[model samples]
Target: MDWRTKLLNPKQKARQDYKSLVTPVYRGSTVVFDEQSLIKDDWKQSENGYSYGLYGTPTALELGARICDIEGAKHTFIVPGGQSAIALVYFAFCKSGSHALVPHSAYGPNKAMAEGLLRDLGIEVESYDPLIGKDIKKLIRKNTSLIWCESPGSVTMEIQDVPAIVKAAHEKGVPVALDNTYAAGVLFDAFKYGVDVSIQALTKYIGGHSDILLGSVSVRDDSVYNVIGSIYMQLGLAVSPDDCSLALRGLQTLAIRLEQLEKATFQIALKLSEIDIIENVYHPALTSCPGHEIWKRDFTGSASVFSFTFAKKISGDQVEKFINSLNIFKIGLSWGGVTSLAVVYPDLVRPNKDFEGRLVRLNIGLEATNDLINDLEIAISKIN
Candidate 1:
């Protein structure tokens, strides 16, 4: 080797194979080819070859493979965040002059995307009742291209009829996209239920902590992959290898953590149901949740997130007192972390503001069940 070439600090001649229990972290924008003559563009085929960092790296691919294994999917794409994964699906399927029927209770940002970018691009975004099942057939348009479902719709917690909706959409030759984040792709089987594209916000459960942000797109068919993958490549969607590594670490303990989260969340939901301060507990496992029967039939289990409203009429000041009285259960947003959180939806997420009463959402975390229950009881006592 020439002295000048050997002087580079980043280049090294020492050889050592990396062997470990975790996936190796690869951070590189440019992949080195064996020889100048062997360079080609197929590297973006993450499943088949080493690709550009924007498409995926070894670290990203490992996480994608892990998600695919859990979801029983043919292919998976790692994206920046859950909302971006949703956007990627939208770009892949919907075209100019096409229309989509979304649940009225979809994640607010997704609804905003439909009304913002998709609408400006000539796609019509419409909202359907979350409880609509086979009846969704009546709303299918000749130009309909996509249908969206979020089981146990965002904050309100109205469980959707996924199977019935999927059947109807498939009959009309349209694709269904689901925000399976609440299920963490664990409670619900997206592909088995006939969903074409399943998106998960790894930030919530797969990350298992509030530390990193990540998302994934799991496809059931090769045809669907080609469509989405094309858009994915063109859009230049990429994620941090460091974040992917963190999620991979989270997977090692996912099963146990999910089990605990399910148990603790259900216990808290049950306790809240009996409390006089709460009128309706909107948990999928609870009978009061819309389409609970459907959830019982389809979902394997529930997650850590749910919502409720106050029973007795109370002023805004009383609600504030309730919030301030809590020792644990800090006021915050997002969920599925080791720390408990609570949020109040005074304006609600949607602009329509259809929901009434004092709507409060809780994300049960890894804490003693009795401690969480007591924290809630103390908070409610101030308002009650």
Candidate 2:
């Protein structure tokens, strides 16, 4: 063979039996086959064997498998990011003329998709109060196909009564899906509560370091798996093998990270609640949160992200100043990373109330507890 032919050869010369404590990043677009008869393309790579990289390389599948093992799911699909995970569930469960119910406090992008893309597609998503647990049945319609619950919802931090909602939806033959990102899948048992579908933005807790963008959609059973899997394949939601590798590493430290984050976050939330200028602290473990009892009953533990509101005396501009005044807490969005962050939601609103820019959300990191508290104290002082 010519020198060019040797250079283009796909066969490996090095031994492939290398073993390590970590999963290696598998990157490739084509999966070569020895026989033409074996050539195929299938998304059920776990059962049917790897046929194409579009479905998932070994690295992506391994991450999905680990999430499934942790979450106790029948199957899990890895998508590009948390929003994609929500999109997958929405597309899978709702179609033209299909009606769905979502909490008013769901992730901002989730609500945007519902009002925008899903609405444009002829699907109607109605928003309901997050606290309307079993009474959710009252809102169910003949066309109601999907119900979404996000415990400790977005910036408002409402811990939903998931079991009650699940029970209600199940009785009416409707499926309940949860944005389980806040609980990081492990802290809360989605399947145990009768949730049909559980999705997470692995970009937050599972990624741990905020360096990767990934998400997972785990189903309670094979029946639900088939429903989500079919749409997952058609959407061509491919993820980077490198990002999967990062998330795989993130899983190793998740338990310890959650432990420290929970402790530090609760401490900070408690301190904030005592301040006269802070009207409320919306941590799930605290009484001030909307569904604290439900959280205690349903969750094994709380996570790092929570929200707080300034007193009426504190203007929206003052809230922004407080966030900017923080030295250690960076001004940013997203949560469950190694760095503490703070951001204000000036335009946040529910049915009867609006934050009026006094609402601020915080993501506590693994920083020293006292240091974080001091940072918040100093910022509050500056605003005062």
Candidate 3:
């Protein structure tokens, strides 16, 4: 049938003949060609054709192809990390004298990128409320080139109406790029939802071990892929072959890990709601979440990444005490690993003026739910 089917069902003879369980990490700067032939010229001349390791190797190609399948994209470009994927899309589409609409409740760095770097490049970045729905049409201008979105947005976790924004942007000949890292591609199909470009940071759930950092941009059409691919080539953005291998390996177990993590996190979120200390819990699965209706309509699953607001003021020392009291949840950066993590989100001040409270973002890992809950209860009781 198709390549995906073939990959899933390799013959026993093929398996017996193969020497490696994993794809051999193709390591080298330049790919060699036969002597005195046009093949070398093709390698150097064609954009999609391989010339050097940075352009792509077998290892990276395998990962990109797999991600493309999952994203329902015609083509894919692997980058250094999720943030770089976002940056690549911005640089590729946004030029000097252009304008872009960005959701107010975006990842802080994305907003910073638009304001600090894109502004310097003469690109005007305008922030619209994520809850604006179809009203986003009001913010679009004649010069608008891109509409940047993040569902279940950063710390505040506001999920936007993707279809409305996509329809509006496409009507105006603008492209929509979504940061789908939160839902991961398994739960939210970006292409199905009308996103022109979908970005994911493999550093989060894809590379579940947290041992590697990688990112990819999956384009809905060949034309858009060509545009992103051209910019990627021109900028020389690439991921290491080893990192690709790790991410690929992690992909095999992603579904199972996500199920366990979601189950654990949902239970923890329910318990958080019962605690008087927690003011608000921003998990998409929770009914109180701002965009739960949209989430219930569009998404198939949720991740362990959710935030809770505290009712009372607490010092950095008290925050540390709470974190330190946890026996299982480690204080660390990044998530989707086997072990649970808890972080005091002191820097998570929402740009949206309506959101105000001290917060902590928890990434419930593949741990016993009761033990994690008990640890949290003990730690939070100590918070003053």
Which candidate, 1 or 3, would have the higher lDDT against the true structure?
Answer: 1
What's the ranking of the predictions by TM-score, best on top?
A: 2, 1, 3
* Tens-digit lDDT track of model 3 for 72-91: 88887889999899899998
Q: Which wins on lDDT, candidate 2 or candidate 3?
A: 2
**Residues 41-85 of candidate 2: C-alpha lDDT, one tens digit per residue:** 889999988888889999999999999999999999999999999
Alpha-carbon TM-score of each model against the true structure: 0.95, 0.98, 0.91
Tens-digit per-residue lDDT, 1-384, candidate 1: 677767864465656675788788889888778888766576346656664688788899999999999999989899999999999999999999999999989999999999999999999989999888999999999999999999989998888889999999999999999999999997999999999999999999999889999999999888999999899988888899999999999999888998999999999999999987678899999999988998999999999999987765765567667777878898998998888899887777444554443778899999899999999998888776
Considering only N, C-alpha and C atoms within 3 Å, which residue pairs clash in candidate 1? 43-51
Q: Look at candidate 2 and tell me the lDDT of residue 18.
A: 90
What overall lDDT goes with each candidate model? Answer: 0.89, 0.94, 0.84
Model 2 worst lDDT window (10 residues):
3-12
lDDT of 3 at 311: 67
Clashes found in each candidate (C-alpha, N, C closer than 3 A): 1, 1, 0
Model 1 bad stretches (over 4 Å): 1-4, 9-14, 349-353
